[model samples]
Target: MGRIGVVTFPGSLDDRDAARAVRLAGGEPVRLWHGDDDLAGVDAVVLPGGFSYGDYLRAGAISRFAPLMGSVIDGARAGLPVLGICNGFQILCEAHLLAGAMVKNTDLTFLCRDQRLRVENTNTAWTCAFSPGAEITVPLKNQDGQFIADEATLDELEAEGRVVFRYLGNPNGSRHDIAGITNARGNVVGLMPHPEHAVEDGFGPGTDGLGLFTSALSGLLETA
Candidate 1:
């Protein structure tokens, strides 16, 4: 089975959930600590959602400098598959792994719901199992979820087909209704939705999020 690393930062709330998702997807989950510099030689890594460092300064602002993040950034640059959710998404932006930044919801409040999203690109390592333009439901809960980027960057992402997921109803005022994005190499992805929470049936929105974890495992097998 593919071994996936799940990094746990101080105040992280979803690392276990992410690990469970990996296990449910038929992969082994490796636990990684924020202060550790090693990645445990896992095939991929996940930065789960939470109020890392208490969301001080800014969401993910503090966690971005954690020792583990240094390795994550480097590994991601070298083609490692990385999935960041919610606060983890903010961390990816803070670390410059992906473009765009997240701000508070347009309504200036924490919102929680089963969100509908359309998969825009399936070329990424974490999304290869999804069909093009597929719509899926996942749990989304966050205080700062609106995604913002300059027009040029937005256009570039669109032109390159890097926008991974788009919200159906534009829940948080994100530009272009963007719910997720991937790096230029399509190995690293960051999204505001909590896909881990939806990976198990009889728990969340549905099992719609399992494809992401399974996709990564499939990609590893193909390249192995």
Candidate 2:
């Protein structure tokens, strides 16, 4: 089975859920610490959600420079699969692994709800099980959820089909309704939704989020 690494940073709220999701998806779960310098040879890495570092200096700004981020940066640049959820997404952005930035919710309040999302791209390493334009329900909880980029970058992302997910109701005021996106090579993906919370049968929003892990496994197998 593929070994998946889930990083745990100070204040991370979803590391356990992410690991459980990986195990449920048939992957070996490897716990990784933020201060560690290595990835423990995990096949993929997941940056789970929550207010890392207590959201100081912006949601992801501090965690982006965590000790372990160096290895993650190297692995992602070498095309290893990486998925970041919510606060993790912010770290990816802060680390410059992906483009754009996130800000306060348009409503200026913490938003939590069962959100509808359309899978816009399923060819990425983390989303191959979803069909293009497929709709799925997942939980969204965050104080800062808006995704923003300059016009040129936005155009590039749109033109290249890098936008992987779109919100159905524009809940957090993301640009072009984008809820998630993949890097240029599709190996790195970041999203605001809590796929980890939706991975099990009885807990969370239901197993609607299982496809993310399955998709990663499929993509990895295909390339292997």
Candidate 3:
């Protein structure tokens, strides 16, 4: 089984859930620390949601410079799969591993609910198990959950089919309803929804979120 690492920033709140999700998906879960530079030889890494640094300099702004992120950025660029959920998505953007930025919601209120999302692209490492056009429900929560980018960037993302997930109801006023996106290599991905929060049935929306972890394992096997 593949070993997946879940990084824990000081204020991270969902690292354990992400690790458990990885384990449930039949992969070994490795815990990584923000202050460490080593990746612990994990096949993939997950940046789970939380208010890192208490959202002081923006949701993910400060956490972007954590010691571990340097290795993460380099690893991701070298074809290591990286999945960022909610605040983790924000940090990816802040680190320039992913494009765009996340800002306050349109309503200026923290949102918490089960959200419906459509899989727009399934070629990504984190989304390969999902069929294109498949609709899945996952829990989403955050104050700065709105995804924004320049028009050219948005157009490029659309043109390249990098927009991996789209909101069914356009919840946070993100451009083109983008809930998730993949890098050009299709290895690194970031999304505003909290997939880790919905991995177990009867505890979350459903098992829709499990596909993300399962997909990672499948991708590793295919590449191996």
Candidate 4:
């Protein structure tokens, strides 16, 4: 089975849920420490959400330099699968594995809602289980979930079909309604929603988030 590593930062709120989701999707969940420098041979990595370092300099500014993140950066660039949720997404950008930065919500307040999103692209390892154009509901909660990019990066991302998911209701005021995005090669994905929190049937936003884990696993198998 694929070994999926879930990193836990000091204030990480969703690492357990992310591990459970990986187990439910039939993958091994390996717990990784933010201070540790190794990934323990995991096939994929997931950076779970929370106010890492209490969101000091920026949401992800501090966590971006965690010891394990260096290995993650190398692995992701080598085409290993990686997924970032909420604050994790912020970290990916801070780490430069993904483009752009997250800003405060357009309303200038933390927002929480059962957000609807469209899977605009399913070619990424993290979203391959979902169908293109599929509509799914997941919970969104954060103070700085807005995504912004320079015009040129935005155009390049659009032209390359790297925009993987878009919000249906335009929550958080993300450009092009983008809720999630993938790297050019589709091995790394970062998004502003909490898919791990929505994986369980009654405990979450329903099982809508399971597809993310499952889809990623399936995509890996299909290619191998």
* Per-residue lDDT of candidate 4, residues 1-224 (tens digit): 78899999978999998999999998889999999999999888999999999999999999999999999999998999999999999999999999888999999999988998899888788887787899998899999999999999999889999998899889788988888898888899998988887887888679889998997778667766
Q: Tell me which of candidates 1 and 2 scores higher on lDDT.
A: 1
Q: Candidate 3, overall lDDT?
A: 0.93
lDDT accuracy of residue 23 in candidate 4: 95
Instruction: Give the number of the best model, judged by TM-score.
Output: 1
Clashing pairs in 2: none
Please report the candidate that would top lDDT against the real structure: 1
| lDDT (0 to 1) per candidate | 0.96, 0.93, 0.93, 0.90
RMSD of each: 0.5, 0.9, 0.7, 1.1
Of candidate 4, the 10-residue stretch with the lowest lDDT total is: 215-224
Task: Give the better candidate number (1 or 3) by TM-score.
Answer: 1
Tens-digit lDDT track of model 1 for 1-224: 89999999999999999999999999999999999999989999999999999999999999999999999999999999999999999999999999999999999999999999999999999999999999999999998999999999999999999999999999889999999999999999999999999987799989999999999999999999
Q: Please, what is the TM-score per model?
A: 0.99, 0.98, 0.98, 0.97
- Once fitted onto the true fold, the runs of candidate 4 whose alpha carbons sit more than 4 angstroms away are none
Clashes of each: 0, 0, 0, 1
Displacement of residue 131 (Cα, Å) in model 4 is 1.1
Candidate with the larger lDDT of 1 and 4: 1
